[model samples]
Target: MEKRRIQIFDTSLRDGEQVPGCKLNAKEKVKIAKKLEELGVDVIEAGFPISSPGDYESVQEISKNISHTTVCALSRAMEKDIKIAGESLKYAKYPRIHTGIGTSNVHIRYKFNSTLDKIIDQSMEAVKYAKKFVEDVEFYAEDAGRTDNQFLSKICENVIKCGATVINIPDTTGCCLPEEYGKKIQFLMENVKGIHKVVISTHCHDDLGLSTANSLYGIINGAQQVECTINGIGERAGNTSLEEIVMIIKQNPHLNFFTNIKTQCFADISRLVSKYTGMKIPANKAIVGINAFSHSSGIHQDGVIKKKETYESINPKDVGVNDSSIILTARSGRAALKYRYQQIGYFLKKNSLDLVYSIFLKYADRKKEITDKDLETILEKANLIKNHSSRLSSDISRHVI
Candidate 1:
C-alpha cells in the first residue's frame, strides 16, 4: 500500500514559547527555524504576529531565514491580526496565515457571546481576508473537540469556500477522548462540503495526556496535517509532541502514514528546544527523554544486553542516540553486573565473581546507582585479583612439582 504523507506543522516557536520562561528572542527563533527546516518540517508556525512587536519581528526574521519549509504566522479571526500576520511573512518563500475563531457552544456563549451563524460569518470573513495576503490560509475551529458536529461541519465548509487551504480542528482544552476526536474528524470528512479541496489538520492539547493519541486517531479518521511542538511544550499542559507523532507513524508501518521529518534529528532538536526553553524534557518522556533507552531492571537489562529488540522497540541510534544504556542499580542481576564490569575491563572467575557479587549487593544497597569507580573499589576491597593471581601461581608450582 502507498503511504500517505502526513504534513508536519511544527508550532514549537509559536505555541511552545507560550510556556512561561520559554520565550525566545528573534535570533533564537531564527536559529530554531533553520533547525526545523533541517529537521524536515513541512511548515513552521513562527509566531503570533499581532500578539506583540517582538513576536512580529521574530516571525519576520524566521520568514527571512527559512526557505524550504512554509513559514506561518498565527492570528485570531480579526482583520488587524490577519494583516499583521501577512505583513510579517512577506519575506517567506512560502507563507501561510493561520486564522480562526472559537467554535464550541461554551466558547460561543462565554467567550464571544455571539450566535453560531455570526461565528461562521466571522470565520469565513477571516479566511477570506487572510487569503488577500497569502494563497495558503489555514482556518482553525478552536475548541472544535467540544463543538457540535453539524455546526463544526458548517463553519469548515464556509471557510474552504473562502479560500482556506487547511482546516484545523483543535482540541483546545484537551478535553476529548481519542474515539470522540477521531469521530469528529470523520464527521467533517464525511459531511463538510468542499472538504476534499482543503487539507484537514489536527491541533491537539495534552491536558488529558491524550494529545498524541487524539492526533493519531485524527489521522486515522482523515486528517492529513498535524500541528505540534518540540518536546510538546505549549500553553497549559502543552500541545501534541512532534517527535511522538512522527515516531509513532514511522514505527507503525501497517498504518501506512509517513512524514518528511528526519528521524535522526529528533535528539538534537529535542535538546535544542529544552536548552532554549529552560524546560527540561522529562527523563521518562517517550522518545527523547534521558531514560528512554536506559535499562536498569535485572530482566530488562539482560534482555537488552542479549538482543536490543528484546526490550527496546525503537533503536536509540535510529533517533540519533549512540546506543542503549545499561544502568547499574541494586535491582540489576549477575548478567548486568558482568556486562558493566566487562565494559570497565574486569574479568572474574566463578568464585571471584561470587565474592564480588555478595559485596556488590551490600554496597549497592547504600546507593541508588553503582558507578564504575564504585565497582572497582568493591573489587579492590575484596582483593579478588590478588587472590586469583596467587591461586594461578600456586597451581603452576604444584604442577611443576
Candidate 2:
C-alpha cells in the first residue's frame, strides 16, 4: 500500500513561546527555525505577527532566512491579524497564512458573543481573506473538539470553498478523548463536501494528557497533518510533544505511517528547546527523557546486558538516544557491573569477579550506587593488604570523580 505521508507542522517557535517565560528573541527563533527545517518538519509556524513587534520581527526574519520549510504565520479571523500574517510570511519562497476563528458554543457565545451562523460566516471570510495573500491558507476552527460535529463539518466545507488549503481542527481545551476525537474526524470525512480539496489537520492541547492519543486517532481516521510543539510545552497544559508523536508513528510500523523527521536530531533539539525556554525536560518524559533508556532492576539489567531486545521493545538509538544506560546500583546485575568497571580498565576472571561483586553488593547497599571511585577504593584496599598497590589509580587521577 502507498501510505500518505503526514505533514509535520511544528509550532514550537510560535505556540511553544506562548508558555510563560518561554520568549525567544528573533535570533533564537531563526536559529531554531533552521534546525526545524533540518530536522524535516514540513512547515515552521514562525509566530503570530500582529501579537507584538518582537513576534512580527521574528516571523519576518525567520521567513526571510528559512527556505527549506514553508514558513507560516498565525492570525485570528480579524483582517489585521491575517494581513500581518500574510505580510510576515511574504518573504519566504513558500509561505502560508494560518488564520481562523472559534467554532465551539462557548467560544462563539462567550468569547466572541456571536451566533453559530455568524461564526461559520466569519470562518469563511477569514479563509478567503487569508487566500488573498498566499496560495496556502490554513483555516483553524479553534475549539472544534467541543463544537457540534455536524456544524463543524459545515464550517470546514465553507472554509474549503473559501480557498483554505488546510483545515485545522484543534482540541483547544483538550477536553475530548481519543475515541471522541476520532469520531469527529470520521464525521467530517463522511459529511464534509469537497473534503479532498484540503488537508485535514489536528492541533491538540495536553490539558487532559491525551493530545498525542487524540492526534494519532485523528491521523488514523482522516487527518493528514499534526501540529505540535517540542517537549509538550505550550499555553496552559501544552500541545502534543513533537518527539512523542514522531516516536509513536515510528513505533507503530504496522500502521504504515512514517514522518520525514531525522530521528537522530530529536534529543539534540529537545535539549536546545529546553535550555532556551528554561523549561527543564522531565526525566520520565517519553522518548527524550533521561531514564527512558536506562535499565535499573537486577533481572532487567541482566536481561538487557545479555540482549537489549529482551527488555526494551524500542531501541534507544532509533529515536536518537546515544546509548542504553547501565547504572551500577543495588539492583544492577554482575554483567552490568563488570562492563561498567572494565571502562576504568579492570580485567577480572570469574573467581575475581565474585569477590568484586560481593564488595559491590556491600557498597551498593550502603550507597545508592557503587561508583567507579568506590570500586577503585575497594580494589586499592584489597591490593594494599597484599603489599601490592594498584597502578590504575595513578592513570585515572586526573579524571577523578
Candidate 3:
C-alpha cells in the first residue's frame, strides 16, 4: 500500500522558544533552522514578526539562510501583524504566513470580550489578508481543543474558503484527551466544507502529558501535518515532541504515515536543542533519552543478552544512538553480571560465578552500580583472572569481528 506523507511543521523556533528562560537569539535561530533543513522538516515556523524587532530580524535571518525548508512567520488576526510577518519572509524561497486568532468560547467571551461572529470575522479577514502576501498561508485556531466542534467547523470552513493552504487546530491549553482530540479532527474532516482542499494540521501541547498521543490520534483521524518542537519545548508544558511523533510513524508501518525526517539525526538534533536551550533531556525520556534503550533487570538482561528484540522494540542505531546499554545496578540479575564481565574480557566459569555473584552483590550494595574498573578489581581480588588490559584488548577485537 502507498503510504501517506505527513508534513512535519516544526514550531521549535516560534512555539518552542516560548519556554520560560529558554530563548534563542537570531544567530542561534538560524543555526537551528539550518539543522532543521538538514533534518528535513517540511516547514519551520520562524517567529512572530510583529511581536518584536528582534523576532522580525530573527525570522528574516532564518528566511535568508534556509533554502529547501519553508520558512513560516506567525502573526495575529490584525493587519499590522500580517503585513509585518509578510515583510519578514521577503527573502524566503518558500515562505508561509501563519496567522490566526482564538476561536474558543472562553477566548471570545473573556479573552477578546467579543461575540463568536466577530471572532469568525477576524479569522476570515486574517486568512484573506495573509493570502495576498504569501501563496502558502496556514491558519491556526488558537485553543481549538476547547472550541465547540460545530462552531470550529464553521471557522475552519470560512478560513479555507478565504484561501488558507493549511488549517491548524491547536490544543492551546493542552486540555483534551486523545479520543476527544481525535474525534474533533474527524468531525472537521466530515463537516467542514473544503476540508479536503487544505491540509489539516495538529498542534498539541503537553499540559496533560498527552501531546504526542493527541498528535498520533489526530493523524489517525484526519490530520496530515504535525506541528511539533524538538524535545517538546514550548509554552507551558511544551508542545508535541518531534522525535516521538516521527519515530512512532516509522516504527509502526501499518499506520502508513511517513515524514521526510532523517531518523538518524534524532539524537544530534535533540542534543543541539537541549544544549542551546539549556533544557536537559530527562534520562528516561523516550527516543532520545539516555536510558531509552538501557536494561538492568535480570530477566530483561537475560532476554536481551540472548536477543535484543526480546526487550527492545526499536534498535539503537535506528535513531543514531551508538549502542544499547547494559546498566549494572542492585536490581540487575546474574545474567547481566555475566554479560558485563564477558564484555570486559573476564570469563567466569559456572562454579566460580556463584562466588563472584556473592562478592558482586556486596560491592553493588556499597555502590549504586558496577563499572568496568570495578569488575577488574573484583577479578584481581578473586585471583582467577590475569592481564585485564590485554584481555580487554582481545575482547574489543572479538567484538569488532
Model 1 lDDT per residue over 1-401, tens place: 89899999999999999988777999988988999999999999999999999999999999888878999999999999999999999999999999999999999999999999999899989999999999999999999999999999999988888899999999999999999999999999999899999999999999999999999999999999999999999999999999999999999999999999999999998999899889999999999999999998999999988999999999898899999999888899888888887776666656767888889999889999999888877776786444422433221121211
TM-score of each: 0.96, 0.94, 0.95
Model 1 worst lDDT run, 10 consecutive residues: 392-401
User: What C-alpha lDDT do the candidate models reach, one value each?
Assistant: 0.91, 0.87, 0.91
Candidate 1 displacement at residue 40 in angstroms: 0.4
Q: Worst lDDT window (10 residues) for model 2?
A: 392-401
Preferred candidate (TM-score higher): 1 or 2: 1
Q: Show pairs that collide, candidate 1.
A: none
User: Sorted on lDDT, highest at the top, how do the candidates line up?
Assistant: 1, 3, 2
Query: Model 2, 193: alpha-carbon shift in Å?
Result: 0.2
Stretches of model 2 off by over 4 angstroms after superposition: 381-401
User: How much is 326 displaced in model 3, in angstroms?
Assistant: 0.1
Of candidates 3 and 2, the better by lDDT: 3
